[model samples]
Target: MKLRVFNIIKNTKVEGPGNRYCIWVQGCSRHCRGCQAVHTWSHKGGELYDVEVILDDIFNQKDKIEGVTFLGGEPFEQAEALGIIAQKVKEKGLSVLCFTGGKLEELRENQINKKLLDNTDLLIDGKFIEKLTDYSRPWCGSSNQRYHFLTDRYNEEIFTKYKNKVEVNISKNGQIFMNGMGNFDEILRKVDLMGIK
Candidate 1:
């Protein structure tokens, strides 16, 4: 299977616990207002990569990464493709974290989405509600979103340490990127003022 990928961050500390390989898949049907990744909402453009190839890359850095994270354009939208990758990640003894705009109950009704969920170690679910934006929770965009620990790989208590935190990285080429669930616009504004890229 091939996944329509928007971008990939080889090493990151903010997407989930520890160091992670983050994959932002292409296409999201839910165009939530004030979404930080609005560029990812469209399904039209993105590169496609075979699932095995992606798995191979992740495995290569298995020693350096705790797990892989599946982010939008709504990971559940490409559930089948990500499901395959998640399963293989498990076989390699790595965990999976998926961020989605869909509710858990709604996802369970679909077989493909269920498979993706089953393979996930943790899930951050719900649409990004700008009005309810929260900065106190770890890995949640808003107060309405939730963290579902589907597997026992991660302890809930660990989240308390990450509350209200954000990670910013400057690439070798001088481009800046940030990973966090809160205050996206504020962070962007700061980045813009810095004129880093």
Candidate 2:
């Protein structure tokens, strides 16, 4: 159940809604021009850990985090493993968000990717288009990419429930951040409880 992961950010604000634990899986052949995780492009560059161990850590931080974010070296490449992890996170009552180089439609067609997205709350998808680069967007590196609300089909009611509540941010300096569905005070409280730096 273990997967190769380039890195793990126990507490991050810009990755997903609220303070989230971001898992950066290793391996991506898509090498977009401005790829931030250049080091993760190689499939053989990461360390492996059991899914249970990663899940345990995330669940244990529930009281201190609003959700979990999956980043990549193309998470969909290990969609099966991602699905396993997502299911466990869902059981913990925390939402899941993912970053990918694949289009939502393309991923939806893949059984494994769909399984992972079944429990995903949001997806920031599309490869980095250097020509369409825009730093103003939330959770996306380039303007060509989009933020897709996959939870419950991006409907009105669902939108209202999550609207303004969940926000992921990326600083100009490449610092990732997330503001959970709850307010800033709640996020700060969770951060304090987690003893996160």
Instruction: State residue 30's C-alpha deviation in candidate 2, in Å.
Output: 0.6
Model 2 score (lDDT): 0.77
Taking every candidate in turn, the Cα RMSD to the unseen true structure, in Å, is 1.7, 8.2
Q: Among these predicted structures, which one has the highest lDDT?
A: 1
Per-candidate TM equals 0.92, 0.77
lDDT of 1 at 77: 83
- Cα lDDT tens digits for candidate 1, 1-197: 88999999888887888889999999999999888898888898789999989988999999999999999798988899899999989888889999989899999998878778889999888998889977677777788998898999987886676655577878898777777666766787877898863
Q: After superposition, which runs of candidate 2 have C-alpha atoms over 4 Å from their true positions?
A: 152-197
**Candidate 2 global TM-score:** 0.77
